[model samples]
Target: MLRKKKITFVINYFYPDLAATSQLMTELTGYLQKDFTITVIAAQPGYAGENHQSKKLFEEGYVETIKVVRIKLPEVNKNSKVSRLKYISSYFFLANIALLKEKGTDVIFTISQPPVLGGLIGTIGKLLKRSKHVYSIHDFNPEQAQAVAYTNNQSVFKIAKIIDKLNCSYADQVLVVGEDMAETLRGRFEDETVPNYTVISNWTDEDAIVPIEKSEPAIRGFLETHGLKDKFIVMYSGNLGLYYDLENLIQVADKFREQPDIVFLFIGEGAVKERIQRYAAEKNLENVKFLPYQPKEFLKYSLNSADVHLVVNQKGIKGVSVPSKIYGVMAAGKPVLGVLEQGSEVQRLIFESGAGVVIEPQNYEGVIHAIHYLHSLDPGELKSMGLKGRAYLEENLTRATSINKYRQVLQAVADNSPLEHTFQPKQYKEVVHKK
Candidate 1:
């Protein structure tokens, strides 16, 4: 019998951690635990934005007996470059200690951006300790940061690109959250053989989340008490961070300040969350309401409660990523007003599913157009779209499909899987950075 795989499941967030990324990390690790000896390395239990904290020392570094190491983060924010760098730097500092110290750590699998620095560290550990490095790219940082204007100076921007590229090319295997992200990397990398790549769209807990039933009068009663009944609830449930383009979303609510029939709700937390909250308050954008992040299982309730679900992302940045929250929104079967690059993965998904409308991120113009168009539709029509979206999700984006895809890739990599690709980076941007 094959000895169980010793895998270091890595990320900056994990269970008892409220971020969506943390939840995803926890679930995937939990699912794979019986087959592998897994240890999760992540930032310790504190999210500055949410005022969230993990109170318990992870059950001997294991969450509910699930193996995990919570490396404390220094500081982080979407807008602060120094804060962000300090955050990534913490990963480098602790990864060496928490990750490298472990003996016979057969494979080092890191989950995303905070873990990008940790990924490089994992690569270093892989060499020093004789292990394989797996870098899972959830969002492509350098380009994503630049697209969002987080780093405007070409100097700092170039450095981020260099670090990002090194993180990608240096790994033994790179797993992406979507095919589009994988293609983006394939278009940029040279020695694709050494740094192997695979795609697994992040998934929802199909088993954990039961079909939503509005059984309780308390449920409808709560909405009624809040004057939210008889309205088309358009909800965006997750973090309001670097990619959210929330200022634009607030302006969308501003445009429709009189559209009382469409109730907008934002339920979650993040670096820019307060700013979004303040704007909503200042504008007296009565259509908008805010709630804190809820547990993954609890999310299904609010998710299915929406009339038209909404997802928003700034333009030119999506090629390097596909937001996993969009998948959850899709899984809910609600029509998505996904505001993104017109031809990007999300927009294409919206079109393919025939479940929702797609809006450009051209600021006010796009938001107004989408709102007006969606509002024009009959409630019955929107519900039809929701049904179509829900069915497509059950058919295509289920958790089993997601985990299986990942297993196939991991199996291939472990088996020294061979692949064929005739594409190369036509526009080779040599990355250069400074400290």
Candidate 2:
């Protein structure tokens, strides 16, 4: 019998956490387990305040074949910038220590979790274990920090920029979540030594998140539980973070406050959750509702509960980040109202899939117009659009499609074979980063 190559993953969150990164890593590790002896070095999952028992080895049956090393670190309030910085610095130091403990591995894959710190740690893991490093840029660093105004200090930005550049050059392959991200990276790292990018859009489990009819028990029960039965729900599920333009969304919700049948739902957690709730309260907006992240098993119901799902990005975040929640919305067979920059990847996807409408950022009137247009559609016509989205998702963004691409990349990198490169850094002089 042939031995499988060893591949270690270094990330901040893993399985138990419902954060987008956690879900993506969990699925990736699970899918690659048969081909690679997987090892995950992650923090004790608590980004969303869900407590998990500390374990040095993630030998739990979640992914029975892989080995997981969970590092112990002080809990910090995510709302506090000082506390988050403390946590990031601590994790960077301790995670490197954990990586140094691992033995021979063929490749080390890491995501941009603590931004550039995670990628830098992957380099250390590669050097210590004598393995190749594959840097997965889930979201761009320094740029993402700047997008959200996470830090105004020039020194911090400079250090992040330097580390980011080093990680780009150090990795054997640079994996990005979207095409614009690939273009952006290729433009930034013009040096030939910098790793080539392969675009791998985030995916959803088709079988698990199949379209649910309103008559389905799961959907019915969810609506009943939330007192949303017979209401036309416009839901924005997943992270309510800094990069999202929710001010206009809130205003849109306020516009429908007098209409008893129109309910705006905001699900999941993030920095902006409380602000959203408070704003809705201040306006006495009775049409809006907020819910915490639902368990994975019940996600289909929560996701499908919305009549028209929303996916939003702020003005200037086109290439720097892509919201993963849109995939789930597509999987649920629901029409989307994408509030994003014009000509963005999200707008393109939504239009291409025929699943939703796109509105420019901060366009409160556009938001109102979109909701009314969707509301004006025949139920059957809306269902047809949703069905188109689900079909598009299955054909283009299914887990199998995504994981197969990853498998090929890993195999090619492992064997020193040529990758089916998607973007060449030298071809483009500038990448789009506009509002």
Candidate 3:
């Protein structure tokens, strides 16, 4: 029996935007389109390089491949808190106006930071229209913001915590990226009546993960331009955000400047990205190179060039955060060397998959040791780790796996279908869908 659902997936950003978070949700919906009628309402200006002010807000007269409504958001520089609040309020007010024209949405989902505004708008819209609401928390807000020190200070975030807890408590379901974040949610509500919850792990496009000998120009240029063509290049590519204490890692690179064969390439942009670049330049770090971010379709080629991939983070922020890079690295089938806080999802993944080794964050000795240990591995051992990581990813983090879980959840609601059922295996060639 085919059934249609009036589902609204709300987020701060969407397609044509191309921010990491935006791409993730848009990718999720590509498969979900088969089951639900999705209406995505997002901001004009995104977290990354999408232009908002010059772009048209509503694609009013056109019915595109997907029914997405864009609301104009006044531009705000992501670096400042005051500007961010103003930006969030703009989305909040605009979405309220939008709700008046078209109301009944079965679920409302939002990514954590600036779009807490979306959560506020969805809460009001749900109550006003007598609809259900759900929050897709990519990152925890207010408190998690403080943990990363992305917020100005705790005192500045006190009032926001009150509102944030309200957003969590009011939602019908809480969807998080990792189990670590789910633990944080339980702490806030701590009460039995909390909403239904699920942890959806990160994913990477399986199709893009081809192991062709890296032929792409960017990958070749990156190696040749830096004289890294001969070196065993260990790369950490992606956003050099505040959440990562990368400047300290660069200090280690300064020490390894003599080992010019072992280069450290930091690609992508963020608040501290430029700062790290400047520090590397000031030290005249011959082994460290900074490159501009490119589109994700180009990322697989660049990622394939690395001999060993790095994921670094600040200490003590574990489970409170999950590095989205792990899944991508796994997808690329590369051995990982992660610098993360202990007792975290990153550590657990490394332990569970036997994919990578974890070095304590801020411990320059650990980083140096890991660099040497990873390089010391025989080619066969390294390949085995990579194989394990890719196998784990294929089993757990693919688009099909996530979508099936989502369908299970939604079907339970849409059909009053109970999830508590015993499983029985048929034949080895058992058919899930008999054609």
Candidate 4:
């Protein structure tokens, strides 16, 4: 029997980690395991402050048949730059060591996490193991950092960008999660040889997170437990991070404080989370509530409890990042109140799916109006609109669809052959640019 080609995934988070990337990668690797012998190099579970018990530099384990190596990393306080630097540097150094220890790797797969270090790991693995490297860019750093003005130092940004561009150039194949991101990849090498890249959309588990009626016991219980029962819940259910403009959006919540029935629910943690929480507290925004990240198993129940979901990104994050939370919102058949840039990938999905209304980022007035407009819609109309997004997801963006594309891509790369199938984005750029 022919041995299955081995693929080593060097990523920051994995199964049991509550971060969006962790869940996505867990599902992805699970599905890919059928065809490839899989190994994952990841940091200990800490995306949601899960406790780590191991003192060893590396702890080995298995997620079914897949091998996993979890590196011991310092606890990261997202708010502190010093803490984050320690965590990133530790993961980068140890993950490189872990990758070198793997034997007979045919493909090295890594995502864009910890900025350039994630891609650098894959590039280094490919060089030492003489394997094909598949770099999946979830967010383009320096660009994403620049989008939100996270840092004002142009010199640091320039150095980071140069390093990441080199990592991309070294990869055998590059996979971007959004069409807009593919354009960003092209922009990286203007008037030069662009690396071989493909646009593959991210996905949520359709089977696992199917739409459930709010009246369902699990959904109802979650709502009641959170004091959201019968409230007009406007939920933002992912990272309360730097990119979403949540700081200003919290003020938008303050505007609705007069309406006792309206609730603005935020259900995750990030660097800016405390700042947002502090602002809400200072303003005494009783309508807004913040919760910690929910377990992966409880995601569907928590998602179904929302009336309308807020899918957003910062203004300049058009191609720099795509919020993956939108998929879960769509999967739960919830209408979206998108605060996304015009022509951005998630914005296009919302428009095409007819899932919900969209307002441009930073348009606080537009957000207020959109919220009122959605709140006024008939219950049946809202349900129907949300179902449209579910329908779109089922037809075009199912997990199986994306997993199969990945399998094909990996197989082709393993064989050192040209990709036979190229997944395109249905003329999105043309449609958006024509307007």
Candidate 5:
């Protein structure tokens, strides 16, 4: 029997981490395990406030057949640059060291976490191990950072951009999560040779997160437990992070405070989570509520509990990042109130699928109007609209479709052959569904 090729994944989050990237990576690695000898190097579970203290700097374990190496790092305070730097720097150094310890690695795979450092690990590992490198850009930094004004130091931004460009240049194959992001990658090498890249959309588990009736026990229980029973829930689920303009978006809740029946639910945690929480408290926005991240199994119920979901990005974030929560929202058959830029990937998806209404980012008036418009729709109309998104996802963006693409790409690269399959973004058919 031919031995399977070995691929070492150097990523910050893995199996137990509740970050969306962690879940995606964990799923992708599981799907690829049959074809590759998989090894993962990741930080201890911490994305969702899980405390895992390890005496050893590195602990090795297995998630089923896949080998995992967990690195011990200091806790992250997302609000502090100093704390973030310490966490990222420690992971970068320890991940590199872990990569050196893995034997017979044929490929090094990394994502754009911790900004450039994740890709840098793959680039350096390629040189040290004489292996092919695959860099998946989940978010393009410097540009993403600049979009939200995360940092104002042009010198630091310039240096970071240069390093990431080099990481791209050194990679054997670059993978971007959206078509808009693919354009952003091209912009990095204007009038120069662009790296070989593929646009692979991210996915949620359709089987696990199918649409359930509001009356379903799990759904009803979750709603009642959260005091959301029979309330008009407008949920924003996922990282309460920098890129999504969520801190500012939280202000929109105040506009609806007079409506006792309307509730704004913000779920998950991030750097700006506390800031938004404080604002809600200061304003005494009784209509707005915050919840911690739900367990993976509870997502289907929690997601379906919402009347309409908010998918958003900060202005100027058109191609810099695509919010992964959109997939879960669609999977759960929930109508969207999208605050996304025109022609952006998620915006286009919502429009094409007839999933929901979209407005320009930073247009608070538009958001307010869209929410009212959606709320005016009858329950059947809202259900039909959401089903359209679910149908679109089933046809074009299924987990099988994406995992198969990843399998093919990794296989072709491992064989040092040109990719035989050309991936074109699916032109989704108009999916009209009745409830």
Candidate 6:
């Protein structure tokens, strides 16, 4: 039997951690384990919850073949920019110490987590392991920092740009989650020798999150537990963080305070979560609810509890970030009301799938108008829109589709051969689902 090539992933967090990036890395490594002897070097869990022991080599129950190695770093919550950087820098400092102990790897996969530092660590890991490197951009670094006004240091920005450029230039294959992001990457290194790049989008496990009737016991029970039963639920699930203009949605909820049936639910934690909570409480908005993220197993019920889903992005964040929750909402067969920029990839998906309505960011009136329009729709019509979204998700954004792309890329890089398949961006007109 041919031995499987080894591929070690260097990330800040991994399985048992609920971060979007952590869960994504878990899913990717889990799926890739069949073809690769998978190993993950991650931080001792800190971002979301309690810390687990920094075990040397622990096997993941879900994927028995994969091994995880955790590193100890300063425990810091991402509550502020300075604190966040401290968290990132500590990981960069300690993770290198951890990587020196790693060997016998064919490829090193790292994401933009500790910002540009994660890629730099991956580059170093590649050299130490004597393996090809694959740098995956989860979010653009210093640009994202600047977009959110996290820092105003020109010196810091210059340093970040240099690190980012080096990571891209050093990697054997560069991976981005969306086409808009790919365009952003191209723009970043326009004058330099461009690296091999591909758009392998984050995906949803369709089988796990399929449509369930609101009448279903699990779905109804979740709504009841949240005091959301029989309400026209407008849910904004996922991280309530920077680069998401959720303030506009909260304002819209205030406008609908008199409407007892309309409830605005914000799920997940982040830097702005407390601020939003305070704002809603000060306004005495009884129809609004905030909940922590549900376990992955309960996502199907939690997601199906919504009558319509909300996806919001901050202005000027088209390519800088992409909301990973959209695909899960799509898998749940739910219509979305996206408050995003015109050319954003989310807007493009909504328009193409006839899955939802797209309103520009920070448009409070537009948010109210969209809610009213969706509420006015016949039940059958709304269900049909959701059906269209699920169809598109299966065809384009399924886990199988994305994993296949990664498998092929890893295989090509392992064999030192040219990638056989590449997906290009195409334009499609907005499809309006007419009754």
| Best model number under lDDT | 5
Off by over 4 Å in 5: 428-435
TM-score of each: 0.88, 0.92, 0.88, 0.97, 0.97, 0.93
On the 0 to 100 scale, the lDDT of residue 189 in model 3 is 69
In the range 311-426, model 3's lDDT, one tens digit per residue, is 87777566566888887788888889999877676777777778889888888898898888888889788878877888877766686666666666555544544544211111
> Which runs of model 6 end up more than 4 angstroms from their true locations?
51-63, 423-435
lDDT of 1 by residue, 1-435 (tens): 888778887677777778777777787778777767788777775563444445543323666556777766555665676887787776677767787767767778876556346566766777788887778888876677777776568887777667767877767677776556765776666454335665566778766553354444545764676677877777888877767778767767776777678888887877777788899898888888887776555677777767777787777766766766777777666778887776566676677778887777766686678777877888678777766766766776788776765655555445555433212221212211111
Tens-digit lDDT track for model 5 on 88-161? 99999999999999999999999999899999999899999999999999999989999988778999999999
TM-score of 1: 0.88
Highest-scoring model, TM-score: 5
Give the poorly placed runs of model 1, Cα more than 4 Å off.
48-59, 75-81, 190-194, 210-218, 415-435
Off by over 4 Å in 2: 55-62, 190-194, 420-435
lDDT of 6 by residue, 1-435 (tens): 988888878887887788888887888888888888888888876666655754443323334778777776666766776777777787788778766666777888888988899899988877676789988888888888887777778899989988898998889998888778877887887786667788878887899999999999888888888899889999999988888877656878888888999999988988788888999999999989999888999999899899899998888788888899999999999999999888788888999999999999888898899999999999999999988899998887888877887888888878788875564223422111111
Number of backbone collisions per candidate, in order? 1, 0, 0, 0, 0, 0
Over 4 Å off, model 3: 1-3, 51-64, 151-153, 214-218, 225-227, 414-435
Better of 4 and 6 by TM-score: 4
Clashing pairs in 2: none
Per-residue accuracy of model 4 over 269-383 as CA lDDT, tens digit each = 8988999999999999888999999888899899998899999999999998889998898898999999999889899999999999999999999999999999999999999
Each model's C-alpha lDDT? Answer: 0.69, 0.81, 0.70, 0.89, 0.90, 0.83
Judging by TM-score, tell me the better candidate of 2 and 6: 6
Could you arrange the candidates by TM-score from highest to lowest? 5, 4, 6, 2, 3, 1
What does each candidate score in C-alpha RMSD? 5.4, 3.9, 4.9, 2.8, 4.2, 4.7
Given candidate 3, what's the lDDT at residue 390?
A: 82
Give candidate 6's error at residue 38 in angstroms.
Answer: 1.1
